[model samples]
Target chain A: MEVTINNIRKEFERFPALNDVSLKIASGELIALLGPSGSGKTTLLRLIAGLDFPTGGQIFFGDEDASHHSVQERNVGFVFQHYALFRHMTVAENIGFGLKVRPSSSRPPKSEIRRRVSDLLDMVQLGGLEKRYPNQLSGGQRQRVALARAMAIEPRILLLDEPFGALDAKVRKELRRWLREFHDRTGHTTVFVTHDQEEALELADRVVVMSQGKIEQVGSADDVYDRPGSPFVFSFIGESSHLPVEVKEKTVFFQGQPIGISEAAAGGGELFFRPEDISLVEAQDALFGKVTACRRLAGTRIAEIDIANDGHAPYHVEVEVPLHAPVALGSEVRFRPTRWKVFENA
Target chain B: MSDKARTSNPAFRDPADEGFATKVALLLLSLAFLIFFLFLPLLSVFVEAFREGWGAYYEALAEPDAAAAIRLTLLVAAIAVPLNLVFGLCASWAIAKFEFKGKAFLITLIDLPFSISPVISGLVYVLLFGSGSLLGPLLKSWGIEILFAVPGIVLATVFVTFPFVARELIPLMQDQGSGDEEAALSLGASGWQTFRFVTLPNIKWGLLYGVLLCNARAMGEFGAVSVVSGRIRGLTNTMPLHVEILYNEYNMVAAFAVASLLALLALVTLALKTLLELRFGAGNAGGRH
Candidate 1:
């Protein structure tokens, strides 16, 4: 269902967790709330789930004002980070909990509940494990069971708080792919919270980047990665080296030396470029530096260069060259920024 | 091995030869004290109870007063344990799951009876239910003799054992937090349903432990029961009061007999506690779920 959060704010005693933030999540769209620890992503998700109330805001679930609604009335499915499954119940019983608790008039029959549970187990790729308790299952299996249990009620929205965070690396990767496929097949409006940017980019159709209890940027995976709106997003979304650049009459200078800016039309701004965007050249008209360290990264040699120009602070720059390139440590190298973006630093 | 080699090898040396005699002596002394001060008295009680064979034991058990006392004690336990279980669950739920003003004071109040002497706890009830108290006239008007009756005995036992269950459950429930309940709530489970399905199952083991402890304390409560029960025969007297009466009447065999029952109950509680720890693991007590 469509969710509209208007001027939502949350506070813990004197500390504000969510600072008047607002966003709209269209129905059937999978979104990821991405942030570092204490960034209010989980708090926002909880507010949307009605597990917590916003200090000041109006939450609308398809024209129904859900600001004062309890979690039970919200009809939202939530998956916890640790997969808080009922240890006392078997997988089948856990999955069938929502159906069992439904009002008698709307409750499914025993056979239908069983069939639905089995169908959910199949959907989550846990077809034959209905008899197993949560403790008896593996971490990934327990997470999948949690997911299946959440989906049993056919909730209007699914909220996952770092669902695959507790799994090992291999299992995390596998679950990420599996979650993408599951979302595609189910087409349920889902919002998951995570601090891992890679998981957000790999899984979410839209990523909501949060910082300091505020939304920094929200966009598609490619939009966020290729065009970060803020410096925090630029640094948080991907790896990049930010070097101080002086703009004089539309000409950018690095380390007190003239740098190539023929393509950069910005008059005066700080230059930001990814390591892969910088090219190591043999000729001049580029910022001069000396190679300090070289490391092989996936068939590419990443050379760390330290600029050595007077009247300029020494800055470390990374350049990606071919694996067979003859780049040696402590050797003089000329580098030029290729694809770069300029931002006004406040 | 040569003597020099044995001396060089610390592992091969006798503890006595290694000059650990003082430590060994201290250890043995403490063990002897423990056996004499603790186990010996326990063993003596058991031996005295069964000394005249099962004949005297059966004779003591056949007494109407003894039967009444045992029944009253069980009745009190039945009333007290379940009441305390409900109270403990509610109190722990409030204290552990919710934050509000005076929370620290409420926690301290819950633990007050544990630190206060049982006699003082009984006195508090007596002060409330005695002839001159506020509710005394109303109770007397209704022909209720709570000060020196079965109700008084139950009240005292309940008072002294009030903290047992809640104390056991608070830390456990607190550590569990609101995560599972929140998950259940978001999944459309109502408050009672969430409690029954998610919250109760998570804390069931802890609740069981608390109930067991509360039951034990309620059954064996003597000081508080004696204060308020008035030590009447076959009327208000409980097991502990009956034991005291038999002992004072110079009926050592019967007195020890009743004491042995209580000791057995304590022993069973200890065993149950150990078995619970072994089966569930000590870490489970933290309520990680």
Candidate 2:
């Protein structure tokens, strides 16, 4: 189901949690609401699930305005970080709960419910653990049960809040791949909240980067990674460094000299580029920063350099170089960004 | 320097480890205190009750007024406990699962019965429903008898036992959280269905724990019931009040016999609580689900 969020604003007392946020999630697409803690990503997900109501605005499920609908009315499957499975119920019972609780007229037969539960258990790869209680299963197994339980309802949209947050790193990676495949198989309009940028980038078709209760940027993985729209996005999404420079006549200047970079914007601005996007240059006009430290990361040598800013504070940036390069502490290397974006300072 | 210091410091021990002498002293002190204050008094109740032999004990318990008091006590508990169980579940569910205005004030109000003297608790009810109070005349005009009757005794018992169930459940439910309930709702379960299938089962153990305590308090309540019961023989006197009346009349054997029944109830409560804690870990009270 397609979801349209129209100027949703939520407040707790006088503190605004989501500030007039708006977005449209297409049908059968996987979206990630990615942000740090307290960034309103979870709040926005809750609003979409109808677990919370916005202070002002509307949400439409397809063509229906469901702003005031309860979670039960919304028919959206939700999975929590802690896998909030009913501890007392067996796996089969948990999976069958939503079907069993339906109004009698629409409820499936007892045998049908059992068959469906069995099918769901099989689909989640827990085929014979039907009698196991939630506590009896491993963390990953319990989360799979939670997902199967959620899918039993056949919801129009699926929502997950840090579904893999409580698992160990290995299990989390496994679940991330499994969830992506699961989403493909089910083809449900899925939206998940996450703080891990890599998880968002890897698992989502589109990533919505949020900060301070507002949407910073919404785009595909490459769009967010290579072409961030804002400074926050640039610093938040990947390993990037920024240098404060002035732009005059479309030429970027540092320390009263043009540093061989040009931009459309005029006046002072910050230039942001990835560590691997720069290369060592022998040009005299290139910024030759003193290497303060060097370290090996995943077979690549990364040197932390500090450029003296004439009379102002020096700027620190990390530049990736060849493993055999002579980049050492206290040595100076001249480098220029191969590709960079300049954001005019406000 | 460290090797020499370590060799010389043979008497040194871990700071967390208590000295043998200190441990022995603490154990002895607590054991002595328990024997004097708790075990002795409890032992005395049984000793005094059975002093006149088992025949007299049976005779005392079988007396008309004694039987009446026992029945009344059971009846009051029967009515009060279930009422408090429902109220406690609702109150704790509200307090633990949701945020609202005046919540702290509501919690403090729930604890009011525990803080005030039981006599005051009973008096407050009397003031609300007694013959001379504002509602008393209105209730009388409607021919309802609450004060000095079974209802009054039940009310007093309910008042004193009100906080037990809610106190046991608030922390447990809070620890368990609303995650399960929200998950259920998002899976298309209605509010009632979510509570029935998810919330209720999660809290069942803690609920029973609370009910056990509430039952004990309702059966043994004295100070509050005493003031409101008017001490009417057979009609309003509970087991505890009957024991007091028997003692006041110098019916030592009967008083002790009745007192032993209340003691038995307390022991049963403790046994059941311990059994619950054993079957379901004590952490079940916190419900770490």
Strongest candidate by lDDT: 2
Top candidate when judged by TM-score against the true structure: 2
Residue B273 of model 2 has an lDDT of 94
Could you give candidate 1's per-residue lDDT for residues A247-286 as a string of tens digits? Answer: 7667787656668774345455567778888877766678
* DockQ list for all candidates: 0.47, 0.57
lDDT of each residue in B55-121, candidate 1, tens digit only: 9998887789998999999999999888888889999999999999999998899999889898998
Q: Tens-digit lDDT track for model 2 on A1-346? A: 9999999999989899999899999999999999999999999999999999999999999999999998889998898889888877888998999999999999999999999999999999999999887777989999999999989999999999998899999999999999999999989999999999999999999999999999999999999999999999999998999988899998888777887878897999888999999989888877778999899898788899999876787889999988886477898899899899999888
- How high is each candidate's interface RMSD, in Å? 3.7, 3.3
TM-score for predicted model 2 compared with the true structure: 0.95
Model 1 ranges off by over 4 Å:
A254-258, A262-269, A282-285, A308-314, B1-35, B131-144, B282-289
Q: How many pairs collide in each candidate, listed in order?
A: 0, 0
Candidate 1 reaches a DockQ of 0.47
